[model samples]
Target chain A: MAVMQIKFIDKIGEGTINKIESLGRIALFFAVGIIHIFIKPFQGKKILDQIVFIGSKSIFVIALTGFFTGMVLGLQGYYSLVRFGSEAALGSAVALTLIRELGPVLTAIMVAARAGSAMAAEIGVMRISEQIDALRTMHINPVRFLFTPRIVASIFSFPFLTALFNVVGIFGGYISGSVILGINQNVYMGTVIESVSIEDITGGFYKALAFSVVVTTICCYRGFYMHLKGEFGARGVSTATTNAVVQSCIFILIVDYAITFFLV
Target chain B: MNTPLIQLENISKRFGNLDVLKGINLSIYQGEILVIIGKSGTGKSVLLKHIIGLVQPDSGRIYIQGELLEELPSAKIKSYQKLLSYMFQENALFDYMTIYDNIALPLIENPDVIPSRIREKVFILMERLGLRGIENKFPAQLSGGMRKRVALARALITDPKLVLFDEPTTGLDPVRKRKVHEMITEYKEHFGFTAVIVSHDIPNIFNIAQRIAMLKDGGILFEGTKEDVFKSHGKILNDFEMGKEI
Candidate 1:
């Protein structure tokens, strides 16, 4: 009975240590990748490719999300605010929600789903195929060759996407709040303009920027250091992709809370 | 008489519970072909990887051109990488790149070279490899043998001082295998470079290697000339190509 208890405790301890080691490695990977972005020689072509993939390719889905999100916010705001004769504040609620939280969080999560998964899959394949070793042999640093551009592209582009999401979302809110719900159009615009502060807008942009870097870094880390323990084929690639997207989504939410805690 | 191109001294590497290489001591001379033969999974390729700095040893030291590899900073190691390149057992071509781009990668990374020179070299090598008109095609479009040849072309394009080949002829047909042997000889003679090949193709390797080393259980069991290997006695010597026993 004592031996069994010791064995169980040992297993738990080893699992905890391994988890901590993985987290430490990820933190180190992110720090080095970010530092290299500034120190590494700029490759315009690679960064542009990432921007095209992560930014332009994502606009359609983001627009659709923003449209529906805004309409929901408008309808909900009308229903709730009308209960207490506070429906006049519908524009403020819509703009604040779109700008302050939903815009950054939803756009980032979408990117984590689409571009993040693809990036992880791509890098994971490269890892399994020994192409990363080839890059090293050819005197090209794999982190700089692969990760820096991606991280930079994500950091630079996600904010713009968040802004686009907010714009589309606000338009949806305006149509639902004023056009459909019989609210005053001029008052809707006026309330949003009057109530939405620069601090709130900038706060959203900050979240977008931070979330972009975190999401991209997590995806790249997952892809580059693909877990080869379980299996080592197509299944491994799929596992890495799924893990990257899931981990990136969780990181996005956690970082969202942290950024909000300090900044907001 | 020339300085050893690479020297491994009491090197060891362990992957988790397995000791992949143990107390390995080997010297690769300049401008000679040294073939390492071993059973599958005996760490022959792992030894080659250590010389090129892809996989660092757990203990002991490696010297390339008289300087300790681990002693150098990463930037210096990277600079040294250009001087030596390894052809992986799995071709390792970038999937997204075309044949032309794959072959042109080294030159593209080196800022000193002109585009015309890159184009000239790539085109010449492609012609030599019978891949001349398919520059734009991706690796997935090529057969395994063709991909291997293309990988060979990419390895040689940089004109490194030493070229490492891991199982150069295992999966190849007779004609392609012979062709690869010829390509190795031609490239070595043309460029005056050393070759370190790890293989299990006994007869074909005997045709090219000045020295042959057999590995077993993560250690060297035999090291001698091709003639000396046939004359050697032991369980390892009796074993021929790919688990064949005589």
Candidate 2:
């Protein structure tokens, strides 16, 4: 009985130590990846390529998801506000929700599901196939060659993508509230324009920036260190990709909550 | 005797509880082709990786041109790396890159290599390796033998003084394997670069090996020329010779 109790405590201790070690490694990896962005011989072409991949290619999906989410928000807000004799404030509620919360969070989740998974899988394949080792053997810093451009692109893409989602979502809200519901179009637009402040926009941008780093760092870290997890071949890569997307989405929500708490 | 270009002294490595290499001591001379042979998983590849800094020893020291590898500053190590190139066992070509871009990568990365000469150098090597007209194709688009030649082309493109090859001809046919051996011999003479190869090709490998090192049970069991290996016929060596164990 005593030995069993000791073994349980030891297992918990080991798990805690491993988690701390993983966090330390991730923090260091993030710092090195960001620092390489400012290093000389900048990879301008690669960064631009990645921006196209992560931002430009994501426009259609972001637009579609944003439109549907905003329609739902508008429909729900109008019915709820009507019961309170505050139907005119429906536009403000929808705008605020989309701008402050759903815009950055949903956009980040979509990008995480799409580009983040691809980044992890691509890098994980390279890791298992020894291409990363090949880069090292050639004296090329694999982090600079692989991670730096992705970091720069994510930092550039996330805010732009969030802004796109907000615009498309506002239009969708207009379609639902004014066109579908019997709300006055001018009243809806007027409330939307009046309620949104510069502080709200900037705060959303800050959240977007934070979420970008979380997504890129976690995804890239998972893929880059896939081999160290004692898995090999296709299984390692699949696990890395799945973990990257799952972790990125989880961290996005966690970071969103923390940022919102401080901002509020 | 001349000073060895690279020397390993009492090197040891352990992966978890398994000791992949134990007390490994070896010397590699300049401009010589040294082949290391052993059974699979005997750390032949690990020993080669140690030379190229892909893996570091758990204990002991490695010296390159009389300078201890671990003691050198990072910049000095990079400079040392400029003098070396490694060809991986799986021909680790960038699948996304074209054949031309793959071969020209090292040259493009080196600040000293003029940008204008990269095209000419790549084309010349491609032609020499019989890889012309396929420069725009990606690595996955090429056959296995063609990919191996492309890997060889990339390794030699930098004009390195020391080249390390890890199982360069692992899955080739007999004709392609002989062709690869011939290419290694011909290139060694043409460029005069020291070569260290990890292979299991046995008698076929002996043709180009100026010196051979046989690794077994986590250490070098024999280190000498082919003639010396044949003369020193212990039971273990006989097992290796008769293709019974190795």
Off by over 4 Å in 2: B234-238, B241-243
Regions of model 1 farther than 4 Å from truth: A1-9, A228-230, B65-79, B111-117, B127-130, B233-238
lDDT of 2 at B50: 89
lDDT (10s digit) by residue, model 2, range A173-236: 9899999997899999999999999889998999999999999888989999999888989999
Residues B1-246, model 2: lDDT tens digits: 588999999999999999999999999999999999888899999998889889989998999888898899989888888788999889999999999999998887665788899999999989888999999999989988899889989999988999999998899999989999999888888888999999988679888888888899899988987678768744666677687964
Worst 10 residues of 1 chain B by lDDT: B233-242
Shift in Å, residue A237, candidate 2: 0.8
Error of 2 at A157 (Å): 0.7
| Model 1 / residue B134 / CA error / Å | 2.6
Q: How far is candidate 1 from the true structure (C-alpha RMSD, Å)?
A: 2.5
Which residue pairs collide in model 1, if any? Answer: none
Q: Score the docking of each candidate (DockQ).
A: 0.67, 0.78
